[model samples]
Target: MNKEARLSRLTRMALGRESSDYLSRDVDELTMVEELKNKYGLENVYRFDVGKNIDGFSPLIQDVLETPELLGLITGSLTEYPENSYQRLRRQLSLHHDIPPEWFVFGAGLESVIDHIARAVLDPGDHVLIPVPNFDVFQSVSFRMGASLTFMEMPGLCWDGNILESLCRKMKEKTYRLVWLSNPVNPTGQFIPQDDIHRLLSHASETRTLVVVDEAYGEYTDRPHAVRSASSLLKSYPNLMVLRTFSKVHCLPSARVGYMAASSERLRQATNTYRPMFPFSWFSLYMAQLAVLDGDYVNEIRRRNQERKKCFFNRIRQQDSGLETFMFLESDTNTLMFRHRDLGADALHGLLAERGFLTANLNRLTGIQNQGFLRMTLHGDAVNEKFLDACRWCGRHLFR
Candidate 1:
């Protein structure tokens, strides 16, 4: 009997949509470099191909990682569901956000949290609004729900009342079941302003739309001068759902830890339906618990990240010319997506590889259509200098 013939409609339907990219993946940097080199057949992929935040653990987190208690989590029994442990984690997160613990929902990462939220909110044939050129993981949420996704162009940092009125009119007409936004957007690395966010929340209130604000890169927005968190809106806007992750400044991408903040009732319901199959190990949870209250450490990271971003910008600019051509588009986040007129992202990726640096070609990403956008995860002065050197080399080759 043929396998296709043997399969039931239910089983076949369960496979849902297939991914265009991969059947398997690992988050390890070395493995990623190897995979990209093999698939693209490039040499010396010294830098990663995506926007990766620099991994820096403070002395507090470092000391905890070295202890026996942290070690115990890895060797411990996996079957025993640690409900109390998670409850404690939630409590700590709530205090950090200045909200009640019941408002939080933990997951493997923001990816799982967003997927579960989409499932919780959407039905078949529903509508979704997401900004263009976002993180690829968020699309999976809409994909699984069999929903229609509309990618909106971003209103830049100074979005005004006219745009807000136009947006509200659309929301009123379509009444989207869900509106997805990535604050300090991935790939672009700029923030949607607070006033603009408030207007969207107001619109969501009218439509009863589930507004998903993914703040995975939230910590990066906290500058040395001023700090802010969207979690502050939870009280007044019950429809607003926010996501935060350990992947960025927390330096726990492999740990796969993240959580969501919303009204207590919504999260309580979402917990039972969403399971983290690539679940957080006991080790990940334990480590998160240790650092949950380290607000000062998070601020220090923000200060350092700002310094690094400044260096990257300065190194790439035409200092004496002062015209600011070949600059990174405005960003408050750690990832920098710099634009070039002479080369498309795909061509630049190849040229950078030839010069022994690896950077992502943003041309192929679904919502991205325009060319010549090369993406890099901005790091400290030393690595930024190396990247600058490569850019200078590539420029000479490209022009001559």
Candidate 2:
């Protein structure tokens, strides 16, 4: 009478492979936070765990959603049942990125895209090279697919010449079917430079390794100076695949839309081998299309995000609170990871949670070891001020 016992042996093994430390505390604590907020009617609870583009739907998106005609489309007969709305989306995205339409493939989200790619390419014992302290999905999916994984520890939370040399040396020494790199890495918020990526891709091309560059936070690096996307290198390096999501800068995570870019040949191989039928709903497709066309809105969001991040960083640097903090430099993403001098990440997380603030505790994430860092997303000025005040209160009253 055990439901879990009925699972296929493969499924059981996959479940067993799940990391006890990766995404365990933060995800579970987030669920608990939501329940308490709803049950106790707590309006002031702040969640810095999830990296949503903004607090809620953007003004333009909300306006589009409220349109009666637009809402009616949700109930109308399906226009493209077999192919769904992917044709339209592919065109828009292609025009946006200046790539051929055949170069794009859609998924419910980046996580879904990652799963699809893993399922298509990974075979039992296939090697996958991933840097440590990354988004846990990379590790989880590759492992579940029964792929051999090699984790390269990124020293100081970012890659340098030594790390790059070591990574390339490993690539030359081993045949990796896939290499997963998260630009502006999750949990760390450090942006790997374009030159370093080029160096890796150059080696990957010779080794015939598929380099999947996850640009989930790549849009955030556009302002002040543009960070050229690895997608631009797709024409030159056919071994490269770039993944992007509308969840972050586009403010449409609820729509569950994400896509991958590669050479048309690579797309054709993946499509011919394994393709998800109608991966996006009509409502999701419609909103995602609108979000994509609203280029001005996206640009404004990026501008404001950069300014707000700068202000937040400077304020943290200048704060006279008893709590001392440390942060990584050159982070161009929505999230920031830092540590309290005197408290472990779990202890600080507990203090903040009690004060109605939820943060991602990095005490046990791979590559972080016992560093005691916690990751929090950048919010608006007012909300960030409240968080800073909470930290000061923890420092002055609790620690002192």
Clashing pairs in 1: 344-372
Candidate 1 residue lDDT tens string, 41-101: 7665665454445656555879877888755665564766544347888877876787888
TM-score of each: 0.85, 0.90
Score residue 61 of candidate 2 by CA lDDT. Answer: 78
Which candidate should be chosen as best, given lDDT against the real structure?
2
Please give the range of 10 consecutive residues that has the lowest summed lDDT in model 2: 321-330
Regions of model 1 farther than 4 Å from truth: 1-45, 48-52, 68-85, 155-163, 223-227, 276-278, 320-325
lDDT tens digits, residues 235-332, model 2? 88887889899898887887888888999585546743555676767777777877877776767777888898888877777756434654434567
Q: Candidate 2, clashing residue pairs?
A: none
lDDT of 2 at 87: 82
